[model samples]
Target chain A: MRTTPAKCSKPNFKIHHRPIISAAIAKEQQIVGENEIQKSGFNFKKYMTEKANSVNKALDEAISIRDPPTIHEAMRYSLLAGGKRVRPILCIAACELVGGNESIAMPAACAVEMIHTMSLIHDDLPCMDNDDFRRGKPTNHKVYGEDVAVLAGDSLLAFAFEYISGFTVGTSPARVLAAIGELAKSIGTEGLVAGQVVDMVSTGVKDIGLDRLEFIHIHKTAALLEASVVLGAILGGGNETQVEKLRKFARCIGLLFQVVDDILDVTKSSEELGKTAGKDLAVDKMTYPKLLGLEKSRQFAEELLAEAKQQLEEFQSLMAVAPLVALAEYIAHRQN
Target chain B: MRTTPAKCSKPNFKIHHRPIISAAIAKEQQIVGENEIQKSGFNFKKYMTEKANSVNKALDEAISIRDPPTIHEAMRYSLLAGGKRVRPILCIAACELVGGNESIAMPAACAVEMIHTMSLIHDDLPCMDNDDFRRGKPTNHKVYGEDVAVLAGDSLLAFAFEYISGFTVGTSPARVLAAIGELAKSIGTEGLVAGQVVDMVSTGVKDIGLDRLEFIHIHKTAALLEASVVLGAILGGGNETQVEKLRKFARCIGLLFQVVDDILDVTKSSEELGKTAGKDLAVDKMTYPKLLGLEKSRQFAEELLAEAKQQLEEFQSLMAVAPLVALAEYIAHRQN
Candidate 1:
């Protein structure tokens, strides 16, 4: 789930009167460890660490300080500042699940991470969300002036397409073009930008309902996540049916990721979250918790998780889908 | 030549003590209609009008007002706002010159224009050049607000890649990928972004030299021009030698475009240019005319025009090369 910092300050708006679930109670309801991971005996924790480390190394190598040091420095700073590597991990997992090796997917995995980082940088700009802190460090605009921050984002966005088109190896150019198309759609008007524009307009709008909220999250958050998995499946040689199934699975989790993010915002503190927490409340922004009540939001999250896992069941190999199952759980249970 | 509006006001810096050429004298030196166009009898004005009309129509069809109307509106507002359509025209002419039809290169032509429009939107942001007007109209930020303006630019950038990858037909996938790579490299840190970053940093510094000024324009201006022509050549099935030659030809004209821009800044009025005139001097920014003096700048432009046309001589068909020869002259003599 992506975290966009609050645009304005203080909580003057009233909260919903629905029964609220405390943070402790939400944490106690663990959602994973069902028939999926146990049957496959997948060590998800170890797998995530190995994949993240590999992704980190690949990302580090993808960009280098060149001609003008400042822009490259700013790009590397935010990109390497570190997140959960959720998108890249998902990309690699999707590729491997469809019979492609890690090496074949590495370029694409790094490309998604780059796109995600670019989104974060742009969202944190003062004109957008006015974020001061992200991932426990100052936001890109705060460290680098707004001008450089903007350019840094632009540079990363351009480089994401370039890297995918120029560096992906062992894949047919047709598949690579298809992957590029998928990735581009995920970020353009129909994807991340759509979500961001809606979110920007809906800020402090008290009457916003579940449909609009879902629209924002689905476009802003779910679109890129869908692309990450879809790119992997396409480049990994997944057939049409397999790619479509995985896309649906990704869409469900993408929404689940945002719903959990809304839940955590109200539950955690800034220090624990590594970003400003309760930002939605402070800004009076509509969130899953605000509309559904904390308890109902938690239930909604669980339903989404179950729905996401159900899409993977038809694959007929519990072992192949184990990582994705654990990933949904990880996103749900993550503290920061 | 692209126009970047001035960031600040008042020209307090001292002008270089060098001989200057009057605008009338510069205009008197007609640089074309010599051996190239005169011999081939290509109607340059009619060709440009037809090509521009085709490109504008394609651009209109490329983007539609979709789900979130504001962002798409802003994109269409600037993208469809009238300009010379130089990049797209160059793209089509180069493709045709390389023995390919216009339909085969239309997607790429529109893609370059989209990228160009995106750059202008970002560069006009409050934090960047802070221009209040562009293309003789209120800037995008003034019309749509900064947040939407930024998103609009982002959408266009992402869509450029999507359109090229998704819409280009009759071209091999490998060729499509290569074209995407060329376009991406023109906009990233090593391309347009690189030039903007340096230009931002050098905004007020007075000791800027010829080398640094060239660096800024080459990356900022020439890189995209080079990409436009190179993409056309590559997509037109040009051999490696032909592509490399066209690349060098583009580089010459790219620098020539900027040099002419600097000269016109000192020589034209805002009303004549349709955008802010003398912005370089107003901001005390380094420019070709500032460093080389107007006379030397004019002389230098002549050298570049000659060199740019010289690279086309090896094509062995004067009929095929006339458009490029006339284009180099058009870029040199355009008032705005």
Candidate 2:
């Protein structure tokens, strides 16, 4: 018999992520016709560490190879840090999910990460967030100083597109072009910039309401998240139906991710959080938990999960689908 | 007729941009061919207004239409200001030159301009050049504040690729991808970032030689200039030889343009130069005139022009090549 909704759902349950695959992975192949509903969920922590190390190596090599060490070094400083490689990993995972290969996704994945890295570098700049720390270490600006940090971010953003453009990804030009377009939209004025603009302006304002908050989080964080999954699906050569479903799942997960981040800002210990805890509270920044009480915020997160799962309902018991499904749930439930 | 290094080539009688195409609106065939070249010269003053207006208009509309206005507005401020659309204009001209087409070149052109615009916006920030004025007006950060300026620059950079990726250019995906890669590499850490780093590090240093000055100018200004022309050629379907030759010409002219700027800093009136004059000197920034005597710098500029024209010699009589032929000379000889 199916477990009760109460039994299946946990508002505060913590998992060591030891089980490896979500429970839905078992049912995937039998239920879904061809989808890999039991795919391994990306280990965000592990993936980040691995990718960060690779990036560091790449940064070091890049520095030695380039004429001007300082500029490349600055770019490398941020690119190598141990931030979540969620964006690039999504690109790879999605490409595989759609039955596409990994080679094509590699460049796109790198590009997305570069763009993401650039954003973080700039965001932590003195004139913006004035952040002294990120990923439990000194921020890019803090380590490299302001000028190099600024230039590094710019370089990374530029390199992102360049990397993707050079990749031997798809056999079709249309698909490649589409991928570039997807990336551009994800990082450009419509996505990151718009979100950043509002966030910067809205700082210290306590009453920013849910709609505005949604707008900020959606563009700032969710756009790239959606793009990441969509890129994966597109890379996988999935049809429009699958793409649509994945996009919706990604969207739900993106929102869930942000809400959880907000909740963690208040609930997580400083050590667990990596960076400063309660910094949001100290700054008076508007956040989900701030506007909606902790329990209600948790409820909103649960709602997002339900919506996300519904998007994948058509795929049923496919093991490949499990990764995304697990990821969405994890976004809501993870402590940090 | 063969005006070689023979008889003091085109002496103080250097050509001026006399747009020979009185029939820009004539038959499509005429407008499509060598005739278009007549209208394609570096009319920095004229192109600046139109290109600046259309691009800024699109930028303004894009930002103003966002859900929250502040962020977009901040981005819009610096972008809308008038500056020589040298890089973008070159892209279009090069595209038109090779393919007799502008359609495929427009997106690349726009992307190049967007990237260039972003650089300027950030260059004006407190952490970088910290200039109060740009193109005779308040720098982006000065007018919009540092935070907004940073976001605006970031927004534009991301949007640059998006514009190219989403274009209806009907060019080969390979060429488009290649151009994007070039753009990314040129602007990213390997090129621009490296240049900016050196520029910042060398500030207040006395008696930096010509080599260091060349390093800064090449990466800071010439990399993108070279990319602009190369991107145009690649997208416009020029043969490899043509593409390479144009890159050489662009590099020469790019450096010459900066050399002229440095000279202007020493010589031109503030009103004539538009922006604050002699700022480079104030910061002990190295410039051509500082390393090489003024007369020697002027001679060097002239010599660079000769080299640039020589690179274009293969296409000299093509008539379509005349604009660039004249344009390179203008870079060295311009009053401001």
Q: Candidate 2, after superposition: displacement of residue B104 in Å?
A: 2.4
The TM-scores of all predictions, comma-separated, are: 0.91, 0.84
In model 2, the Cα lDDT at residue B311 comes to: 62
Off by over 4 Å in 2: A1-65, A168-171, B1-65
For residues B146-246, write the lDDT of model 1, one tens digit per residue.
Answer: 98888899999999999999999877999999999999999988899999999999999987876578779888998899999999999988888788778
Best by TM-score: 1
TM-score of 2: 0.84
What is the lDDT, from 0 to 100, of the residue A93 in candidate 2? 62
Return the lDDT, model 1, position B93.
81
For model 1, which pairs clash? none
User: Quick one: best lDDT, which candidate?
Assistant: 1
lDDT agreement with native, every candidate: 0.84, 0.70
Q: Give the per-residue lDDT of model 2 (tens digit) for B1-336.
A: 111111112222122221111122222212222334446543544644665565555445544545556656666666667665667767766776676466677777777777888898888778889888878888878877887777778778878787787774767777887888888888876567767878898999886655567668878888899899899889988888888878887877887788889898999888898888988888888887777768767766766666566666566445556556556655767787
Top DockQ model: 1
Q: Model 2, A1-336: lDDT tens per residue?
A: 111111112222111111122334423422322223334344445644664555445434433436677666667666766565677666666676677765666666777777888888888887888888888888988877787788888778777777667764564766777777887887766688778877877889868776667767878888898888887777668889888878877776777788889999998887898888899889888888888788767776776676667677776435555555555655767778
